[model samples]
Target chain A: MGMTIAEKILARASGKSKVEPGDYVVGKIDLAMVHDLTGPLTLNVLKEIGYDRPWDPRKIVIILDHQVPANSTVTASLHQQLREYANKYGTNFHDVGRQGVCHQILAESYVKPGMLVVGADSHTCTLGALGSFATGIGSTEMASVFLTGELWFRVPETIRFELKGTLKQGVSAKDIILYIIGKMGVDGALYCATEFTGEGVERLSIDSRLTICNMAIEMGGKTGIVNPDAKTLEYTKCDSCEILRSDKDAEYQRTIEVVLEDLVPQVSLPHSVDNVKPVSEVEGIEVDQVFIGSCTNGRLEDLEAAAKILHGRKVKEGTRLIVIPASPSVYIEAERRGYIKTFIEAGSVVCNPNCGPCLGGHMGILADGEVCVSTSNRNFIGRMGSPKSKVYLVSPETAAATAVEGKLTDPLKYVRS
Target chain B: MSAIKGKVWLFGDNIDTDVILPGKYLVLTDPNELAKHALEGLVQDFYKKISKGDIIVAGKNFGCGSSREHAPLALKYAGVGAVVAESFSRIFFRNSINIGLPAVISKGARGIIKENEHISIHLDEGYILRENGEKLPIERYPDFLLEILKDGGLLQNLKRKFARRGEV
Candidate 1:
């Protein structure tokens, strides 16, 4: 008779007393985000509706990434379209260099516990780390939200992930998610809400939690939810919020308990995120590129982790290492902490916040027969560049270590004692 | 109810939206231009090899990443009949249904069908006709989704709804 976190959030957003899995309800959207890659289509659809203005301009956030600095004339025009729409409607727009990535910027300011966020990008689930219910939507669906500020939800069934024990040193939240994805396979949590709870999750930093929730989509999850705790409250400075929780007797479609103490460094092999192997197994595999960034792992902590490994070491010859902070805030923090200078001195190309190379947009695209060990999610064939190239997914620690030895080397040996 | 027939084109698990339509072509607003590049990364000459009524049969987690409607739009414009999979991503499932492309969920379908094979689907009866003449039950959807498909998609259905509202 108790409700899960997702059920409670949907019920509250829809103004209903009670709702359950499989029930369709239209919920009020608190925040909607769009970036340069998808904003033009979203704006065109809204224009087709003949809307004099947005249903609520302040409710939306727009960022120009994917092709920052205008990779091409086409991408340049896209930024223009988004800018014109934002100016005409007086919506909140984060111009180039004003922000890094949309989700990172949104979490820094907009996201709140128990809010419902629908974004135009799949990584919108990254906001779920703040204990908000968020998911991706298409341009037409975004247009509907622009016109009515409402969208439907199916009150997804919840899958409880109870993390026990503590993560080993040199192992990170990225490894935790990669291990889960490997165990469950790609379709493990299809159409379900995978909620991370228990003591281990409580100890995870906001960046780690964001990294975990960002990949919930890889398992076909509707969204990943973590109840607002002390850390959440402290970070958001939100006192006396709704603070939703699943009842002790709440029903779950599946309950997976991961023991962090036993987990070692994990690496997702080429072509598939679910194709995972322990770092020991893939040791000595040489790589041509080393990338440490994405919405999944481009936070300040991620940069710090890489910088810690590359502080006084130079990258091996024939290896290309690129570092991108998740946001301008992260970049500024890295500068203050001297991680930027340390990286440049160590032979890594530290760029601004953008989705470059992750989706093959720009920056460090790979060539045929090349191999890259990356901190980003999704290692699908040709994800970074040529289909003949290979991508190995690892933690920032492993990426930095690999960049040094020019092979797949675990950072555990190189971590400061 | 009519039985839709098509030749099967097989694929494995997790055929994401990005592979269906790569990010490189996302800038092109034209659906026809997108169709030309459909599955071209994995399958060379994908658009040319696809028959008008060819159906795609894949393993679990089909259309997994990204919510771009351009994905299903590419397949629709490329003349794919329907996508039969073991499971599908939630957003991609809804996008495909709204776009009026039949996305049938038939468990163990990958083992049942092979490349370039023929299969038949009974939309009303919720079953698939294997080449060996065996019937496999499919997960049935709400009548409303079929109603939308019958009227040729959500866009057309919206037109009908607005027309009816004017009469009221």
Candidate 2:
């Protein structure tokens, strides 16, 4: 029987010729990641079990993306502990100022094709855009991996999403994913491996592909994978590497077809990531804050998109706009390109590269009875602030346009020179 | 594993990690401190209301978003004996097991179980005994997972394994 790319990757990691769905295999870890929020718990678990050192320090990656710069005394202490642990173990650590979002940092260089990766953050599946079978695990499970360098898995059945045609001007990979999640519902792909393929996927830039894969977890996907192609090779600067792809006759539990040419700006209403609608349906709803960064949409292209929209315009008088780059590299590049200046001139507060307001970790939290138009993933209830506050998830362009009007506005509704 | 008896708390679908334990409280490491915020997003003062050994019976897609293990740890520390749901998100399921929280999947758990009613779960026997004297079948844990549960979570299980091999 033919095997999918995920099955093939699992087979290689497990030292088997092939693996079928539901088959259990204990696989070696190529890379493991954890951030400030989850890292301390993992170390504590190891200490409780009396394992003082990681199996392979170099294989582990730690970062201070969440609550960076220390939101409180507790967070400062947690960051201190992570710094100590990273020093003791000699693991690859990206601390404050040097850190962006965890997944974004991995995408910058750490992630490579065909590797079996795991992280303590659910959004770790975002790394799968690099063609790795990466997924999220609990901190306790990560402790086991830290010591043994191995974790068991029940191979998930694969769900293939084949996109075709060109994306509309204002429509983005974020919209495409939001539309899929809306149709599939929250548990539509529970415990399943999702593969994004077809010509439309090939049309996506590496950053856009990352955006699509980052939201797979919103629909309960174990991981979202994209086949490594020429664009992927260029991004990773790989001269020679095995580019894994599914067989022509490989089986998929189900296949969803998306026609990208017909897609428009999509928005996820407050309280749920999957409660989506066309931006036109919910346009003009007032917003108090606008966020333009997170692991989902904090890449260079996303910043450029927002900057382009906000370049010559001013943010509405009553609204607040906050832009955060995903990583230091993105931060430098955006600054070099003057997007940062454009944002500041537009009356938006451009923060450092970290997860701000997305998880309500820090930087820009919503107040009671307020509404926010954000480009981040997951609009779950109270995700950004008070339980009474509401969040609407939109594309970067939409976020910027909404910021301009202090309401939910479609990007295409305005004309740019 | 012995049968666990607890009062029931009913919840709807998609009780995500943010609701289970909001991101603002992710900074806290102590389980007891984390417990104070359990379900605070969904139900105010829920932790104070919960008696030790209260089971949560939820609709489909419980623990749907975020891979924060704090969610399960908070539930465990908040005196939740087990979580009986129609289904659960993959990461949540794994986190629950790793934290020694029993997350049982019984299709009709929400419909058959009433809030504030008492129920008993026989994990090893693969059924939940409700106050109505009805036995509801649950999806049994696989052998490896069952072993982890028997040892009271992955931490203890790993300790036992390492001790046997003389690695720690």
Candidate 3:
């Protein structure tokens, strides 16, 4: 039977017919996730349903990144609940402290080509970077997966984003996505699948693809995918899994292309991810906080890029710069490269590996009327604490440079060649 | 239950799940406790002022986030009469119906309604009546979904379905 990449994968896993966008199908899940915050509730639900054993222990991954190190009593309690559940259920991966955000850890370790991954967190779309059709579900659904190893989905219409041209120096993939959001608006990709391809995407690294797919939720996309390539294979280390590309005549609901050769660093103004403009247009917008962490850009490459600009420099007085590595492995890698030292020497506060300050859980929360430039996805009101606090979404380079300057600036101005 | 009457509060697009129930409060299990935090992130003290049977009017993409059933549970516990949005996050919309909450979609909600305005929602009729007597049509719920809501959430509905199947 003829099939698109998504249809082929779902059909194999779900044992369903040729699936198309908007067609509801139920399939076995290749993977499922739960974290400290939501694990207890899921456990409680499972108990209520009287499921003595999980459908497959190997497919479940439990994590404690939301409040890593248990900063408070509540967080500590949440962690305990997760540990208990993982122990009882025999979860395959129990990532704790600095292990990194769930999405990053999954991408680094388990996510592979053609897998259907689902998590209880929205950013689970990060696994789409590995050519998996991954998306987020809720605790109850996760509980169901734990019981039956299966879930249902309605196929989504596919929107093709064709990128062309090489990115300019100091302009990262984050900037490119920000630019796309600027053009398409926050709701542009709502309820659709975003398929990235073309010359521009081919030039980006796997980590960069993770960054792009990670933020698909901001555009309201169900998930995002890129045709697996050499780089994707290298990153995932999946030699045995087959790599699927869109058929030459594959159908798409819509297509949009971007030329990256002349693209500048982009910034998404506060209150909405789609409220974007070029960095030059919003220069001199003073910032009180600068954060470089979250599943999106908290990888090793992201830290290295930020440290290169922060070396031997001091952050602007009155500004708080927070850098959190996405995972413990990323933290170790950064430490080995002395990136952490450079960041601290530059007057930045380095936090443990976790999704700190990105979702306003803990650390780096902005004060009322304050402005922060963050590398995380989503700058919606109260996203980082206090609805009055404004957040500007930008690339790590822009975030680092702005931390030093206390305003939005091009990182090229300070980066050493 | 007594006939609930209240005014409708209308909002514009992209009302995410985070706004309805902040991620920070997801730990709480009590629906009443969660009800107090509903929309706390956006409109401070929303729960404290909300009366029984008040309605929410919003533009597209309402209830989008980690499909915590708590979202609709909190809204229902807060005594919300019905929710009218232009569009909805797929899971949240389904969960609302599964939990017996009245969630309707209407294109004209944003243009005609205001925050804290007095109105009446006729669930069976699938329309909202404004103080000025303007009636806005809403998408009617499917028969199955309405039946599930009437039975008070999916778990109860599922139990009934299984019991009937067992007898057969």
lDDT over C-alpha atoms for residue A216 of model 2: 92
For residues B26-134, write the lDDT of model 3, one tens digit per residue. 7676779999988876777787777888888888888765556777878889888778888887667766876667677888777778888887766677777788899
State each model's C-alpha RMSD to the native. 2.3, 1.1, 3.1
The alpha-carbon lDDT assigned to residue A82 of candidate 3 equals 73
- After superposition, the stretches of candidate 2 with alpha carbons farther than 4 Å from their true spots are A415-417
Error of 3 at A101 (Å): 0.3
In candidate 3 the C-alpha lDDT for residue B33 amounts to: 94
lDDT of 3 by residue, A1-417 (tens): 355666667766777656777666788898898887767767766665544368788999987877777778877777777777778767865556435688988988889898998888877877887889998776766766777688777777888899998887888989888888788766787777788889888889888999999888777777888888888888889889977677877788889988888788889987778888888888998889999989899998899889988888899998899999988888899999999999989988999888898877888777799998999987866778877889899999999999989988878776645
lDDT of 2 by residue, A28-111 (tens): 999999999999999889888887688899999999998888878889999999999999879999988788899999988688
TM-score of each: 0.95, 0.99, 0.91
Best by TM-score: 2
Better of 2 and 3 by lDDT: 2
Flag regions of model 3 displaced more than 4 Å.
A1-3, B1-7, B65-70, B98-102, B113-151, B157-168
In order of listing, the candidates' clash counts read 0, 0, 4
Writing each residue's lDDT as its tens digit, candidate 1 over B95-161 gives 7877778889999978977788899988899999988888988898777778867866655555465
Comparison by DockQ, 1 against 2, better one: 2
